[model samples]
Target chain A: MVIDQIHDLQQVYRKVVHSMSRPGSISNLNNITEKLEDDLPCNHAFFLCALTVLDAEVTFHVVASEEKKARLIEILSSYNMSRIAPVDEADFILLLQDAPEYQMNQALLECKTGNLHDPQQSATWIIESGLLSNISALSLSGPGINGTQQLQTGIQQDFWQRRNDKVKEYPLGIDLVFADFSSQIACIPRTTAVTITEVV
Target chain B: MIAKPHFAFFDEGSKKEIRRATLKAVAIPGYQVPFASREMPIARGWGTGGLQLTLSLIGRNDVLKVIDQGADESVNAVSIKKLVQHTTGVSVTEKTQEADIIQSRHRIPEKALKEDQILVLQVPNPEPLRKVDAREYMTKRMHAEDDYSGAWLLLFEQIMKFGRMSTGASHPVYVNGRYVMTPSPIPRFDNPKMHQSKGLILLGAGREKKIFAVPPYTSVESLAFDDYPFTVESFEGKACKLCGSTDVFLDEIIDPDTGERTHQCNDTSYCMEQLNSEEKVEVENSYV
Candidate 1:
């Protein structure tokens, strides 16, 4: 069954809002993801998120191998009519699975963290991961969190370190959206303070 | 019969644009995010911003509540609720606790909101520095540089003249210890409700073309001086004439015949609920 662009995307956007506001909370996008056509290079959740937010007004970039990157860009652009841009200029950047440390660092370093005047111009990185699970725990405390909440994910520690470094300056940092193959997603806006509690 | 408007009166593209800006607003806590505001059937400055947000966020499963000046049946609230229901066919309620999305102007609900609920406040001015600095570019720079002297000065002048901070509504608050934001034009009593709130609070300014947010559990402290602390409007010894409730915000009413003054709950739905519940208890006692 094909997804209803209006109805399905509305549901997806609300879930995104839910997870983004609460930071550590996980939202399931399976209902929308399942309706997507197969044979896509990226996770359905990432594509759905892009579709929900992207348009001709915005630009996006995909961090994948040369061939996969081209295909993802073509697919996203064709679907949403959004332009593809370099990492630094992109409004939304998608990091594909098994992205090497160097590429991750480059994307993080180059992505736009808007200046003081307009901090909302920063890029939102949508990272594809193995699974959204309790294999490793992250302690999150900040706006939106009541006291301290634990987030469990399979993402590597290095990425968290890079994220922390990038967000050291408040009001000028990139936001992150992590999605897994199981259609589980979570968001870590720049406001949340993330500390790796346990990595197993 | 008139043709049904595009599912919430906005095309998918417009919805996408608003959603993106809203996400950025949420991510940044209190920082204003600019977006293309669409022209609604209603005129500007008439709850259009909150209506736009409600239209963008509403789904088939959602229940919406609209309030103006704490009254559920006010002209502005009723018009907006009718438009939303006409376009989306979603349920509209007067009960705050039963609502999934509560779009309000000038007041927060007297009752506490749950984690799942969302509060959309209509904002006429999104910039906290607009009053201090007329130039938009300069205000942007001031925000970037963490220069808030003008904001404090505004309050200081009020204190110097009135012997107290006399901001009746739309009190400026420091959000997340980073950006200073206007908590809309909600009364001073409603300002504290934004702090550490369990429900997500999204503010939209259609005329200003800006959207901002206060995520759940976020710190929202009203600007105050060391010598003079922030205080809400005192309703001490004042109770609602209709419900006889003293804890809620009240609206003073003047009787034309005798020139008598009385107070009633500003939140009409809340007052009605209280009256009904009390009546129910009395009826049960009589039956026993």
Candidate 2:
């Protein structure tokens, strides 16, 4: 579907900003049709985020199987016009919840955790999920959080542990955007202290 | 939400670019994210950074307030207010409490900002290490390595030279215990206002092509040695002549006739509000 590039992107960018600044706050991405095109590998929320943030200036990496990666890249490129780069060099990484945990971890490990001076140089991971039930509950406390907030993230426990491990280095980890199928989104910046809650 | 021709004097493309960078800045709180800073009608050093942020975030419903050094009537402030108003047609206000977005040159408002408000600071040099090392590459490397000893050393040297730490403005601060950032050119007195502030503080350096943020409820500590603690610009016995407020940051004005220097609160609106109140409004001390 043809969307209003300027207005749609502006609305999407505001949602991304809102979600990123306030961790675990759900915001919906606008301008997406109810029907999903067969060619696209994921939901329109991911595409909306990719379109708003990815430009000719930045490169993106899609983490999936070989077949899925190529298709996702094609779809992202068609929508955003971002350069497709290697996993380590990419500014943005798109990972699906169904993607193999090992592959996801490998791609995330390869992704740049920018050095102390330019932490912003690191990659932003956009993990997409189909359902809220698939996500794990996490207790979050950090800068943007008021006191302590409990959030259910569309990320695997193993991967979440690995990601949290990477941030123990502090100021040198990737920021995350958790995008759900219906376009509901939340963020977990690197500075946030996240703990996996035990399921009762 | 009206489809204005160009939202806030910038085309959608420019606003999108700024929005992208701003999101990154928020995600990586206190990390300076480089962006393609466009040339504004105003000069580079005089708050183009803050203007870019203000324009980008401004919506039809936003209430904007612009301040230079502290006064809303300053040339820089008035010019910015006019430019934003001319473009977005957003409502403008002089009161700090009423503004949704505040674009400031140097000083933060005297009253505490609310959670919904945003404070945009026009940063001259976003790099706190600039005073220590002139080379940008080395400074970047230093920041990458978390080697902020140079910043501390610079402070030490200042104490050595002045017999005490005498950084007047643009003092270095540590945000989220990560990056050492210049809290714009606000006087030392205003530095404490940033610590776990309710409002988000965005710092933009147009010439430097960098933007950083201190998100709401974040810890922002001004760098200081334990013995020689971080201190604000002192005005212990001084009170504003107009408002009679002693806690607020004061500006000393000299009379040409008698050559007598008298103090007045730097924040004009807050001072006026205080003066107009039937009962005295006390600003709680936030000093370290």
Candidate 3:
């Protein structure tokens, strides 16, 4: 089920760019996952995002459970021979939906928040969510956003708060991508201010 | 014999690398993301950065527009347009409305860009603090610490030396209210068009090997003191000699025979369009 690397990667990269630029906008990356192995612990869209972003030059750290990490590394290595570094040193971090809140917080704190002069060197988090759209939502407002936008994600309030804390320093912080089961994606860059609105 | 150029002139790997960097740039507005800028037929300091961006993002269906100093026929612009056309065989257009991707050096199009259009600006030096601090690491530290006193100090000195701010081109702007970015070397007159622009603006510096962006609907305010206020290059009563259009930014032209100076619209294509339109139809074009 291997897809066309050059063309598929280009198409996926465009969708990812669209999502990242306009925070909270849903971009469909459906067919990008057509090539992933069937039995992987996580959805294929996340892997599609990984391959589109991470390459031989950039190292990635898998923050999921031990089983998922092993499988994730195996699949990722097939795409590139880049070594997996520790969470703090990794250029990209892949977190599964099942990853504990403590692990999420640890990754948030330990991941490289690039220094002011080289903020572009900061880590980007690609988090997997259970569903694409839900009743509960997260409010986002920042640079790319017109005013404010709201999108549904499976992430908890505590996680959003932790993310906010990490980004208080302005330019030196991690950017995030949320990929869901339906192959829909959303982003929250470090410059964005995020709030998990409670579902009433 | 010279070898034939590859599609878009760069290898697939290079294009992929650029696309990745571009996505990261858009994700984090105004923050300069370093990329492995490839050597093009053009020199580094010219429009190579914008060229790389245009090459990478260009699909077979894209209609490209290239401009230098507001003229599509400028040497730099023509060279780039020919290079891309030769490599990708993509249709090139002078009409701003027809272009999907517009690459330019030092000027934004006179017509307002739509949300679907992408603008790639060629930047000589991406660092706005280069004048204030020579060391890259020191400036990085300053930006990290949210310390931009040096930037303000530089502006203050300009005000002290002259009666008012004298920055004509390459004016510094605060993007998304986060990072102070140089909107390339575009005249201050074009700076206002970038504020919450409908189109996405990507700035690339080939020599510097950096890329950054101002996404659609984002705020881009030029750096100015509360008392001084941000001002664009003014052309109050001046009108283009050819089209008699008074609103657009005008370029001064010397009359060799009469030893006099007259003005013409800096944007050649827009000027041509104006001259072609019989009546001086005035809707107060939103661009100004």
Best candidate (score: lDDT): 1
Candidate 1, residue A116: Cα displacement in angstroms equals 0.9
**Looking at candidate 3, what is the lDDT of residue A104?**
79
Any runs in candidate 1 off by more than 4 Å, and if so which? A134-136
Looking at model 1 chain B, report the run of 10 residues with the lowest lDDT sum: B43-52
DockQ of candidate 3, scored on C-alphas against the true complex (2 decimals): 0.53
List where candidate 3 sits over 4 angstroms from the true fold.
A31-41, A100-102, A133-136, B1-6, B276-288
Candidate 1 per-residue lDDT, tens place, A1-200, comes to 89899899999999999999998788999878998889898889878877888899999888878777888888888988899898999999889885676887899889999888889989998888777764438999899898988887677788889889999998889898888899988899999999998866
Interface RMSD of each candidate, angstroms, one decimal: 0.7, 2.0, 2.1
Model 3: docking quality category: medium
Q: Highest DockQ, which number?
A: 1
Question: Could you arrange the candidates by lDDT from highest to lowest?
Answer: 1, 3, 2
Please provide, for model 3 over B189-263, each residue's C-alpha lDDT reduced to its tens digit, 9 standing for 90 to 100.
999999989888999999999999999888889999889999887788888999988878899999899989899
**Candidates sorted on TM-score, descending:** 1, 3, 2
Model 2 over residues B152-214: C-alpha lDDT tens digits?
999999899998888889889898887888999999999999998988889899988998998
Decide which is better by TM-score, 1 or 2.
1
Q: DockQ for all models, in order?
A: 0.90, 0.54, 0.53
Clashing pairs in 1: none
